[model samples]
Target: MAIPGAVGASIVDYTTGFPVATTGAAPNNDHEAAAAGTADVVQAATSRSLYVSAVPHDLLEDLIITTAGGYHLLRPVQTDFDSRLVLYVWLDRAQGNLAVARLRMQKLADELIAT
Candidate 1:
């Protein structure tokens, strides 16, 4: 929750829809449901060919879902072993800087995979 406007954050195992860690308030006060939703969204995006990059070998990096209340940012944690994790953060649209939050999430995701 160090990031401005961050209402909730979670490190989810997309493959299993499991939340490894979570902090702050969940969307409906349920972290498990939020993690499952995160996994579903990521799965939908990755499964659809429309989201595929035109550039050969390019992969999906992140996703941003905008709601009236906040912005849902999802960053896939890429690792040398298995890249099945996603960092999800809910940011209040009025107070959050999307660009900065995205950058910070990218760094955090990298650090997560490093450890």
Candidate 2:
């Protein structure tokens, strides 16, 4: 399924803000992606007005993001990651949400198998 206005998408490790894997977006080297994701998380982690808070380091796992032009939706996906990592998604602010986007990502993640 195609999400409208979905320009860029990637799975970033919260520990470092890097891409575990990416699609529908420009290619990012693992180190660069990790750094970017980490930076985004750090940027958000310090904000008091964010709709949601970062997972505690002890609880950090996977994360997700969905955004458009006006909103950026983010969520942690490692409820089961044993506090090690997370998936961070970045969406265009105009087309993202805090609740629904992650559910969709969760659905997709559920279908993927670890090799």
Candidate 3:
């Protein structure tokens, strides 16, 4: 998100749970590292749940999923065929809204940002 007071934001695919895009302090910080680590943790620990964990987010695919402190949102998108994908986002708990952020990600994903 490009909102003011935003600390950091990232798009992760829960299917392969990893960071796709990150805006803010990820370059120097371990934000991306933590994201990738969490994804692996989810995959190894909760693979049976509705939460589909992914590999490194940069590897790529059709899912857009997100994970933030106090929030984990998954927005699935549809293509012309039987394919399906989700949009993922990560935001800080104190500064982000689970509902509005999900909506925004849904809008972005609808525009084919999931790919």
Candidate 4:
């Protein structure tokens, strides 16, 4: 939530590559596509981690994708309900602070577990 120039945010199911909840704006206003695409990104990162570490349970805490125009922060949310959930935030790089966004995303993940 502290992410500056945030265009949108969503809670997605990585297993199904589908969005469970979404807020704010999405590129082209296409939340579904964004969710699915981002989920693929998460899946790829996880696969790479597994290949290198040889541990399927070795999960990535967060992944940052920096584009020419903005930053995409993907944070995995592990809760009692499900571990396949992820939080995605799209931020304008010119205005966004990566460190602050990461901290906020961690905090949000904690709060999500409490609920």
Top candidate when judged by TM-score against the true structure:
1
Worst 10 residues of 1 by lDDT: 47-56
The TM-scores of all predictions, comma-separated, are 0.92, 0.47, 0.46, 0.87
Candidate 3, 81-114: lDDT as tens digits: 7532344444566777756765666667667644
Query: Which candidate, 1 or 2, would have the higher TM-score against the true structure?
Result: 1
- Model 2, position 111, has a per-residue lDDT of 48
RMSD of each: 1.3, 6.0, 8.0, 2.2
User: Which pairs of residues have clashing backbones in candidate 1?
Assistant: none
Candidate 2, overall lDDT?
Answer: 0.47
Candidate 2: stretches off by over 4 Å: 1-4, 26-70, 79-83, 92-100, 112-115
How does each model score on lDDT?
A: 0.90, 0.47, 0.51, 0.84
**Predicted model with the maximum lDDT:** 1
Please give the distance, in angstroms, between residue 11's alpha carbon in candidate 1 and its true position after superposition.
0.8
The sequence of per-residue lDDT tens digits that candidate 2 reaches over residues 13-97 is 6555665666654324354554475547655654453433444444323334333343333345443445323343445556655
- Give the Å error, residue 79, model 3: 6.7
Candidate order by decreasing TM-score: 1, 4, 2, 3
Off by over 4 Å in 3: 2-6, 12-20, 26-28, 41-46, 50-88, 112-115
The alpha-carbon deviation from the true structure for residue 96 of candidate 2, after best TM-score superposition, in angstroms, is 5.7
Q: Which candidate do you rate higher for lDDT, 1 or 3?
A: 1
